[model samples]
Target: MPDAHPHPEPSPAHPRPEPFLARTAPEALHDLRARLRATRWPDAPEDAGWSLGTDLAYLRELVTYWAEEFDWPAQEAALARLPRFRVPVGGLGIHYVHARAVAPTGPVLPLVLSHGWPDSFWRYSKVVPLLTDPGAHGADPADAFDVVVPDMPGYGYSDRPTGAPLDSIAVAGLWAELMDVLGYERFGAAGGDVGSHVSRYLALDHPDRVVAVHRTDAGVPRFFGDPAELAPEEHAWLEGGAAWGAAEGAYAAMHRTKPQTAAFGLTDSPAGLAAWIVEKLRSWSDCGGDIERSYTKDEILTNVTLYWLTETIGSSMRMYHANAAIAPAQLSRRVEVPSGFSIFPGDLVRPPRAWLHRVANAVRVTEPERGGHFAPFEEPELYARELRAFFRPYRAAAAS
Candidate 1:
């Protein structure tokens, strides 16, 4: 007789049969628009400028557009053009996109791409196509590989963890498990902002599995024992950066202390959500004082809509509080994996080679002449080239 249990039907040979569609129910958008129209404005001091906070007039205009002209269905259709998948890992339902190369002999080294705060997996949409289909982007066919982009737990379609200690370390573990489940024993990783921090933790904790790691703005803050130990330039950078943080990072502070309270405003009104998020994209990017030049208004709204539609703004921000409670000695145990850094000009603190070497392999560091915190989105070609170069050595070794 044939084996009692024949091999289970092989999973669809193609990992992702269809790209992710927004799938936001029509009622949800109607309710969101209703909430936006019903928002109650708060009074501010006379002569209060953006220095005091987000401009009320600008926010109102944006809200007006969101209600009247913004097209979520159109954006939804655009997203559906790319392949997406969901895999169960660590008892959580993780949503990700897996795009494969066209060439039959293309390398199959898996790559897990992570996104950071004030952004979602959507941030990687532009670069994902380039990485998976290099030939289509005018790059060598040999450069192509399989790409995986996951919406972190409590973000997008992924199931939210209630009162879960879902910090960077925990998330990194989940990524490793996801790779293993997908049959990738070893893989490369890349991220920016909070994504960068998680990528570092992933490489550090699972050095053997992570063949190589790359980050755009790896959020490694300056460490000074005392004021006297700081170099002049380091001190100047710290002071200026601190001043900017104090003036602008109220959201971080709130997220640290009372994320639940802040979530009320974000969840209650779409206009409030727009102000909270759009400001960061404007201030943090290399926009040269023009937000439109860096990102389209539709791009900004799409990011915000992902958060609003999923109702994950609160759980996502809770990560800051969870991490803040951990000590530095515990945070910087030194990752022993090959690492690459792309220091964009607009990062909060641009670390010198010496500083990054202390924590990671620091094999590749590029001070790109252009781009900012959102490097992948603002300069996709530069980002793709740097990533390919950093991982080339490892890719060659794996192939051999």
Candidate 2:
């Protein structure tokens, strides 16, 4: 038989590498608190619920706590523990934490983990230790992996490029290059939300390199078909979700159409930042009536502060605009790679097994007892267990 495989080359224009620096220290938290305490809050009609969108009174209260009680230094110290590095890929400086397992053995499978909007590399901090050092979590040391978590372009420590389109597909190509640079000839990929879309593209476009792919949210069915041709259940799922999203996705629409205009308030006022992000945590998470139970006040503030300090509010939102221009048909190209899907209860759309089976080689489908959009942070144990089981077969196959 003829050789059916060939390695790919890196893109000519590489992303510029930028130094990773901590913008806020423990002392800065004090200054932020002072600003929050002095905030002149906005007025709202009495009895306004979330329908009015982040009641000013409620936000003021959160910000007051954030300013007075949240510890930035503690969060920074935790992040500093990770071994982070910056690399240039596709004209954007990418920051990633590359944690290798301590096991004395041959190369382990390289896994590139990606994060979505309203999140940062911090989302995976909890999962990284588990994946890279499974023994520490009371799992087999052989289950250890070389974990790579990158802050998507225009997010976190990565440099946001101007006049360049950085959609999910393009970002996938960048991941391929980053993997190549790190000397990983083959690896697995996993992500949720926007990360899911990018991971799909990586597996599809570079099937030879991506041994397996995992995603928390599947792509919208419309990306895979004409509504008229979709199965009745699929149509209902998409339409119902679209209607709800349209009604509730004011943030998405605003971000897609005019991110810069919206960035002003979020970047300037810490209160505005909390109101915008806190609502999503509350509404989208499976926290059993209290978001703080799933996520600490410090956790939420750390993510927000990453955006505010880096001034990435506008750039991160630009992803929505970039993706909007890509046709659904284009986004739906079949990903011919082994895939895994975890359908958490609170996901925007819980795809039926039949629907996902049509898209990729879905080997594992998990119905978590709890958790939502932020799987890694919200339910680390469940997320870690599902990942281990999903990749166990693949890891065994590779060994054989």
Candidate 3:
């Protein structure tokens, strides 16, 4: 990996970005370990595994490993090697990774990748290099992208919102301004989770600027149009969504309603934070019930440690509340921009062809055999290929 340094110095055309290095003060890390070690034990039934909630036995083992063996410094060093920068966007210093395409054989289209909650820019880190330099990774160089992944406000290294938390629409406006500052006249947008909503808004609000949009899953179904118009697959999807919500939507409900109450313990206890995030990682991925099957201990800790060190968990969850307040009309607006969907097998809810077409100018859709909600991190190569193929047709338009 290249040594970390500021790229593209300040010039008349483009504002310079302050190079950002991931470094946690020694005292902060020490305090985290102390908290992990001092956690008060919680009792669970011997047979309760993940049936009730986060498994107590697994959490205990993970916490012990975190306190005694997890190396934050090494992980921090590895993260710092990525080309990270913070630039002023809408009066906030936004942290993002800007990696120019390597040895492009054709037009290098600028692409901004948005990440959702629970994980920040870290969600797309593994796939950055793959998209930026496809030839080196055994793919066509013409498919390379000038990749940009921004940490949404109140997530990762970005500044937390001070007043009202930003919903997806507000975040999309911020991203448009960000791309403007980066000198990209037009670009492609893609994301999953909350990010998928942001990208949808990006295409809706800036149709002229975004050549195309791609997403992993459609946002939680809204059921705006008449029920009689729905196809069988769409109806089945709605039923599946309701079933998933009944079984697994409690966390989202808490985030939408009482985030602050949960934030207290999550912020104070590293073990609590890990349990909160790890359970979702296990349940939401194509891991076959084992989280390590998708992400190793170090990979999982890197994401959790970011939340722990940044103290952004509360602000991150508050986004749900902000999004909840979106007007029904805005939520119902259909996107006209060219769009694509690559629904991973383990993702939360898959919107069928009928639902996808009802929402956007659906052009391409695929169902990869493996991966899940966190596909970029869980299956980087496959994720990269999806973007490469979906966006290939739009590259000429982007270049023009």
Candidate 4:
């Protein structure tokens, strides 16, 4: 089996990416604790619960655990267990976790897992082993993948893009360069939320380079085809999405408009950062209003701390501004590559199959019984299964 895409001239050898270890300085950890301990309480209607925003009682409880109980060193060490590295790509030092699989026999496809907002590479932390060592987890050894999970700029250990903005389209181009740097002329792409959008663009912008793409949710454009002529079920899906937007889309608007204003408090106050990020983690998760049902306190704090320690809340929020600038034509571009979708029961928007077909050349679609927007983290086993089944067909094409 040979590579499907035209191979790049084996150019001047690429530099080895420097190994990276995720360790917050002791002083930074101490400062984070101080800020959490000193957080000022905010009042809310006694019975509003989460109707308003982040619940006051929940925030207080979460903050207290973050200040007194969370162990940053332990979490950092757990993260370090992955093979992480930082290399200069797209004019910035990019951090990523790379783990190659020694499969049983067949060709091993390289996989690039992209993560969404409110998360870094951590979202795929659970999925990496499943893809790279499926047999160890009781899955087929033939489904092994050489996994690469990059920390999107400003989201984690990656460099902040404060100098300029980047939309999903631009990130797609950058990803192609990163894949080439890693000696992968072609690779599979998969993601959820913002990551799903990035995967869509990667397939759209670099169809020849992307062998197949899997997404937990359909990256269907907002205005797909026309509203005047849609199937009854499609019409209902669109209206439900619209209703959800009117009710739950304010935060996206804020991220697009006044992220700087929100970033000040989030960057300055650890609690502020937790409240902003944790709200989404809870609301969007399948936890049914109780955040504890989905994520542990340490899991929540670890993600928020990544933003706090790096002081990248500003740049992360600015991604919304950048994406908002993507031209409508580009947004509506058809994804010509083989596409797969895993529709989780509790996902933010479960677009009908018809809607998905309108956007992508969808070859596989499944609705898992569990999970939500954070599918990879919430249901790693199911997420891995989705990828395995979706890409199984392309094995020969991808391998050769």
Best of the candidates, TM-score: 3
In candidate 4, stretches whose alpha carbon ends up further than 4 angstroms from where it belongs are 1-12
Ranking by lDDT: 3, 4, 2, 1
Query: lDDT of all the models against the reference?
Result: 0.78, 0.79, 0.91, 0.85
The best candidate in terms of lDDT = 3
Model 3 score (lDDT): 0.91
Instruction: Write model 3 residue lDDT over 89-192, tens digit each, in one string.
Output: 88788999998888888888899999997999999989999999999999999998988899999999999989989999999999998888777878999999
lDDT of 4 by residue, 1-400 (tens): 6643323332246666889987677899888888888888887887988989999888999899988999988988998999999988888888999887855457788889999998999899888899988999999988888888998887899998857678888887877888888888788999988899899999998888899999988653377466876778788887888888888888888988888888888899998889899999998888987888988999888888888888888888888888888888887777879999999988887899888887889888899988999988888998899899998877667666
Clashing pairs in 4: 2-400
Q: After superposition, how far is residue 254 of candidate 2 from its true place, in Å?
A: 1.3
On residues 249-293, what C-alpha lDDT tens digit does candidate 2 reach at each position?
Answer: 889899778888988888777777778888887777887657778
RMSD of each: 4.8, 4.9, 3.0, 2.9
Task: Show the lowest summed lDDT stretch of 10 residues, model 3.
Answer: 3-12
TM-score on alpha carbons, each prediction: 0.90, 0.90, 0.96, 0.95
lDDT at residue 125 of model 3 (Cα atoms): 88
Model 1, residue 14: C-alpha shift (Å):
17
Q: Would you give me the overall lDDT of model 1? A: 0.78
Name the regions of candidate 2 deviating beyond 4 angstroms.
Answer: 1-31, 104-107, 223-228, 396-400
lDDT: worst 10-residue window of model 1: 5-14
Clashes within 3 Å, all models in order = 1, 4, 0, 1
Considering TM-score, which of the candidate structures 2 and 4 is the better prediction for this target?
4
